[model samples]
Target: MSRKKYILIFFVIILLCLSLVSYSNTTIGRVLRFGPANANDYLEFPYHEISTTSTYFKFGEANLENIVKSRFYDVTYGNNQKVGDLDQFLEDTDTTSFIVIYKDNIIYEKYYNNYNRESIVTSFSISKSFTSALIGIAIDEGYIKSVYDPITDYLPELKKRDPRFSNIKIIDLLHMSSGVSYKEPPDDIYTYFAPDLRKLALEKTQVVEDPGNSFLYNNYNPLFLGMIIERSTGKTVSEYLEEKIWKPIGMEFDGSWSIDANDFEKMESGINCRAIDFAKFGRLYLRKGNWNGKQIISTGWSVASTAPYGPENNEYYPNIPIFKEYPGYYSLMWWGIRRDDKNYDFYAAGNHGQYIYVSPEKNLIIVRNGISYGKGMESEDMSWWPIIFYQFANQFPSE
Candidate 1:
């Protein structure tokens, strides 16, 4: 009976028939596989079937772009169980693209299911706010100095493959507090088509806790700040986001930015613009980083990236909706919450119910992409989306 144990039981029945046809999540097997219960079926699949299983960067010529429309209005509010009716929360959160930009037109736009306006989706960690706005334009062009250096001083291969991320700073991985050791299960095969999310962040991440004391949602802290912005700006990260913010903030199209199987750059959720180039990066941080006037980025790094650093400015309470009542903070990569008259709001959140919601003192801008299914929640826990965009940005008039 031994012909080399019958060829090792016929290669364990060919590895159990390739793990029973490799992918599942019902509904006719999620157009055939990709975990996390259909990974929010990612805007209903098709970016060339996740670009033939991932490896990206595009960001090509938007060629002096910007030409948006749809200044449609009429957002009269009323009911309140955390604000409702934006077409019943865009048909209960399968929203494809919703936009609203106040002080510069397009005050309400829509496009769903069959998705439109040149549909380029998949910006899951909202590209960690575009790799923390390219490390705040690589620390305002000095090419990485501040943010208290030491991300192994520009990835010295993370001090030879993770030496407790060798003193991990760069504002503690832009405040998500790089304790590294990755974990975001509910099926985290969600690393933008992870056949290899940068070799599991350089072989299964480490330093179990101790990078500027805590706040762990570490997507390898912008995949090590996109290898310190491509080793301090030689280029790549779609050529420094198309030469510092997509051809000088006129982005109208041609965007992409996902990569893993070796070409690295999936910096904590690869980008894929559109939806008015994510509302022109929420109107370049709602005007603070100027665009048309060209100051680009550096209204003091967009007010130190949506202000309120570390623990709600040290009072504590954050970890992305952890235990709720968010007086939030976790800066430089954006996401601050505050407001009870204290005023503060900033966002760029992604993964199903993708958003860019910025509302600098009411000079609003809200862009929301979609494909939110069960597990990767947020349509703000099923259609409350930041209290219906802060009650529709307090129904206008902050002229």
Candidate 2:
């Protein structure tokens, strides 16, 4: 063989070996193969299945479905522009599934991109909200004494690493104000793909600010909460979720939560289930954590999670561009926007545009799942969704 041919063969062999090394099970391997995170990433990672109750609760169809299909309001430039067809706009935005519930009825539900009612989509950071709810349930069940309890009380090993850990309260984690040093590129990516998440959490968490002093939206907060839940409840977060919330409220389908190599649930993210089931979670919060007549989580917790705050609490909200124009707020992992009536509309948002939005006064709930955040009027930080939701909900006649 010629010298050039031999060199080419050698390089090709080396490339093949590297590809085989990262072909599966590792974060880099998945990213190289599947590209960035998407709505269907549940298939990429090992997960723990959360079984459903024998009896399931399903939303009833409204007399008139797709009631708000005419126009989509655009508030990009602070003006309402009646856009084109609503369905087409959703398609243009890469929406995989969109649902609307009013008066506990499925008023409008549509699936796109080969997705349907039975399709499974990943929750991304929306799982953080679920983690927050679990904390409230843990407290109610007496497994956890109180939110004021230092997290080290549950994960005492953290105190051994740093005595300052004793100062971080459970509420600090719930509020994303635990002062854990976190950055999106390295920290977020590392936690998402770390082979041993529990170790990374316990060893790598370094306090940058005093607890409850500022909001960083650190993913590590939920991760630590997952550890706390496991220690306090003597069950995995997935198990607690299945028993405390899922089965009790009658989730229609069995869900799953992603886990690391050691089998710890990735509490920062990784909930996977159907869009309708996602709406059920929204309904739970909308009705003040009550399912039918059963109180799943205390009404006080439900109210406090979504309630609005004054500008004084602005630091607690995500430091995003949209907050400059809209009084956007974050409380206990839930995002909110102050309405003109001084009421607040809250929602759970995740990466790549997963949302479970609820308006308490309107008795409305909306769920959105997407492959990617399709073309919108503004960036992800300055989303047009709040306006779209407000306009759509207002179209209905007064109760």
Judged by TM-score, which candidate is best?
Answer: 2
Error of 2 at 140 (Å): 0.6
State every prediction's TM-score relative to the real structure. 0.32, 0.92
Candidate 1, residue 273: how far the Cα is off, in Å? 17
> Against the true structure, candidate 2 has what lDDT?
0.83
Residue-level lDDT tens digits of model 1 in 184-222: 662244444555554555566677777766666666677
Best by lDDT: 2
lDDT (Cα, tens digit) per residue for candidate 2, span 304-357? 877864336546556676566676767888988876665678999888778899
Residue 7 of model 2 has an lDDT of 100
Poorest lDDT segment (10 consecutive residues) of candidate 2:
71-80
lDDT score, residue 193, model 2? 80
Which ranges in model 1 have alpha carbons more than 4 Å from their true place?
Answer: 1-15, 20-95, 104-106, 109-111, 114-125, 130-150, 153-157, 161-199, 203-221, 226-267, 270-284, 287-298, 303-399
